[model samples]
Every structure is written in structure tokens, then in C-alpha cells.
Target: MAKKAKKIDIRSDGREFDELREIKIQAGVLDQADGSARVDWGITMKRIAVSEKTYNKVESLREQFYIIPRGKGGKKYLVDVPAKLLDKIGDEFGDYEVVGEHFKGNVAIVAVHGPREPIPRHVADPYRAVLRFRYTMAPFSVPERKRPAPGRREIEISKVSREALQGVVFANEYPMTAIDIFAELLSADAGTRVTAITAASVALADAGIPMKDLVAAVAVGRAYGHLVADLTKFEEDAPDAVDFPMAVVPRTEEITLAQMDGRIAKKDLDELVELGIKKAKEISALQRQALKEKYQRVVENEQ
Candidate 1:
């Protein structure tokens, strides 16, 4: 007789296979820039109230968790605990309650400046404006302090991001000029490039730049023998992982950027691309909503 296959639980964070991590975006976050946006994209972890004695046990590792006082006087504490750690410490807290939740993921800020004259007059194109993108990460973005310099990875992401939005911008309208986009990752878990691209699109719109449509991006891949819509850092590091990030124009469904890191069957690749496009549409809606909210705020301010 054939043996029954054992069931495998792929996701430990309780997210659906096709569901994306919680994402919050705000446009016009910076006043000095022509346009700016901030995106907080990541998972939400439950905050549990614990006694002061219990909190002290993990004080040395506080950086890894979101620790805060439950209320005034600092009698009790609330820690945004990860799923893995919950199993070990869940019983230690004395009469604790599930207080709330907090987000832990990539935080990206993007600023857009100008349809101004290009630096070094000779570099300006006669027929269309040039698009320049600068992608950088804060020194404290990751667990370890990163060097404050543009490394090869940053340079490559900048190039791809510039290309991703090039097709949407009406560059011909402002010939002999430059549109500079700056994206900074304040915190990162995974999918930093996609978060930057998503924020940059909104920043450009907020700057009043004419564009065909907003570009939305997401990463879709296979993890633990299952096809996933958005791969977290845990999934990306899986033994049999395939990380494919793509940027798409929602209206026309044009693929602006496509990058694959691991190998997969052709059939699986097709399915993954389709999944990415679907997720991109959802992201596009959020981008539009953020722009609308910014304008609404302006109207309220004037009133």
C-alpha cells in the first residue's frame, strides 16, 4: 500500500497563501520636495501584556521585539511578539492580555524633484526628459549597520527602478530636463525594491508629473513547495525558494520590470507572473487612494 503524504504548514505567520503583508502608504510626506511618499509594508505582530518581571527576562533582546509600557506608571509592559517566540513565553506572562499589534517590515520614503535642467548640459536629451533614480538604505535599515555608500546592489536597483517608471512618464512634454527620484529604505525585512518602486510611483504623481498610469510592484515566488504571492524573508531563504519581483502598469497591464533569482518550472513561472500582476492591481489602488487623501487634506487646509 502507498503511504499517505504528510501535510506541511507553509506559513507560520497566519497569512493566506495569496495574501500580502499589511501595507500603509502616505503621499506628500515631505514639504520641501516637489513630491514625496512614505510606505510602511510588512507583517503585523500581536502585542502581549506581560508583568515587569517577565519583561526583564528578555530585556537584553528588546531590540528584536517592539517593547512598550502598557499604560501610565509603567506597571505592565506590552511586547510585540513574533509567532516563534510566543510559543516559548506565552505562558510566562502573568494574567496578560493580547493588547494590540504592531507592524514590522520595510519602511521606504521616496522624494521626487523637478523637471529642471539636467546637470552637465551635454547629458540632456533633445527629445525627452531624462529620469534618474537613486536607491539607498539607512545605515540602521537592517540588523547590522550598513556602509553609507552606494554599493553595487543599490546601483542595480536604481537602474531597474528608473527603467520601471520610464514608460509611464510623459518625458516628451519636458524635453532637455531631468526628473530625479530618491528612494530611501528606513527599515527592511524583504521586498525593499518593490516597496521603493511602489512609493516612487506615488511620489511622482504627488509632484504633479504627467504620467500614463501608476506602476505597482510585488514579489511572487515559490516557497516550501507552494506558490506564494509575497515572499517574506523567511520564505525567501527557504531551501527551495524562487524569488521573482515584477512591476506592472495596472491599466495596460504592461510589465515594466521582471527579475527572477531562483529557478522554477516554466509552467510555475507563468502562474507566478499572473499572480504578481493580480497583486500589483491591489497595490495600484492603494497608491491612488494615497494620492486622493493628500489632495483631500490640501482642500481641508484651504477651507
Candidate 2:
């Protein structure tokens, strides 16, 4: 667990500009991979490896964007550890909708694979498009962590993560092809899943998977009863925050994910969503800028 946030030095100007941290990109970090890059955005970082395999389902070649959803090779819905964590996530989220993309400082690596079997009909939900994610903490991600095992908090974040992302996927298109996005966290931040989802989208795109749009998330936390755009792990533990772990995608300019764990008035719901949507767009814009910069370098070097 982290401590609450303290003040930081703003620019010389009196304006309190939300200090944008550095986003460092290292390309081809994996020697054997067809495509791999490590994204270090401020406290957030993800090391993604992209490799391609032939698909027997030639019919699905039309999908230029795909999302590879994977878990810890098990069923997690309403299960043991995940459920308990979800309960706590609910407790924290009850107060406010922490909006934005990615975990605070989590690092993930994603890999893409081939056309697999379709999901069985029995387990599929009629109302929801399923997006699966597995979140783990490295043996040394945190200050006092080990064993490389996830705790209740990780499970809880996974549960809500699908909701944050379902609206952005086109699962019906490539019915059976599993876009496997595997993330091994070398570090833990508040926005790992959001980071993973962003990385997953890029990995899927690199794998030639198509989608309607790119989705991104950011977390907003309350401190001293004040709404902060992105909350660090330490600040999240602060009692002032009535909400925990909120993610939003800016594709439709509306909130697709909302969850809380503390006390808040019902009237505040719309306000929180509005704030979340607003910040999500800002984060999305930054992601697009990063993507543009990455691709531009590729083009320039090719020339």
C-alpha cells in the first residue's frame, strides 16, 4: 500500500498545470520478437512483445484489429479471492467514480497469438461483450512484496476492468481467434490494467487486428475532499478518497465503466461520470499523440 500524495512543485507560472510526466518508449526490447517496445510514461510503464503466427481461419483476415483476452488459466468470475477484493473495490468506489486510464505505475508485456476455438455458449452473457484480463504483481513490484502472486486487490481490479473495456471491443467480428495479451508486471502502479488495455490495443493493432476505436483509461481520486485527475498508489490509500479504481474510455465521449467503494450522494453520479469522461478524453488525446510519435519514428527510419 502507498501513502497519500503530497504537493509537488508546479511550473514557474502560477497556473496549476497537471504536470505531465515523461513517456519513454524503447523499441525492440525483445530480440526474438517481430515487434516489441517498452513504454515508460511517467510512473506508468509497459513492456510489450508482439509476435505473429499464421491463422488457419483465413476467413477472419478482414479483422485488422483484435483484442487478445486471457486470464491465469482459470475461471475468475465471482470466485474466491477476486470476489473479496471486488467487495472492497465496491467500498472504495461507492464514494466517487475514479475516472481515467491505466493503473498508476504498472508495467505489462503483451503477446499476440492465433485463431482459437470460440467461447462456449453456456458461459457467455447475453447482455455483455466479454473482455478478460489477468493482473499480477511481480515478486518485486512493490516495496514489501514477493512470491509473484496477486492478492485480493488485484482480483478486484480485474473484475471491474472488463466492464471498463467491454464497450470498446468488437468481439463478434473475430469470433474464435484469441488475441492473447499476457502482461507480467515488473512494477505496480495505480493504472496497470488501463496500461494493459492500452498496450493490448497497440499489440492487437500490431498483430493486424482491427477494431472500431482505440480505448484508454485514467484514474481520478479524491484527496482532501478534492478531485484529483490521476491518483498515485500512495494517494489512493488516503482516507479522503471516497472512491477507488475508476476507469473510463473516451471513444464515445461517455463513461463505459463506473465503480465505487465509499459514501457519495446519488446526485453526484452524473457529476463524477462527467468528470471521468472529461479526463478520459484528455488521456486519450495524450495516447494518440504518443502513438503518432511512435509511428512517425518508424516512418522516418524507413525512409
Candidate 2, 150-179: lDDT as tens digits: 678677765665455556667666653443
- What's the TM for model 1? 0.83
Please name the candidate that would achieve the greatest TM-score relative to the true structure. 1
Worst 10-residue lDDT window, candidate 2? 75-84
TM-score of 2: 0.61
lDDT of each: 0.84, 0.47
State each model's C-alpha RMSD to the native: 5.9, 18.4
- Tell me model 1's lDDT, rounded to 2 decimals: 0.84
TM-scores vs. true structure, each candidate: 0.83, 0.61
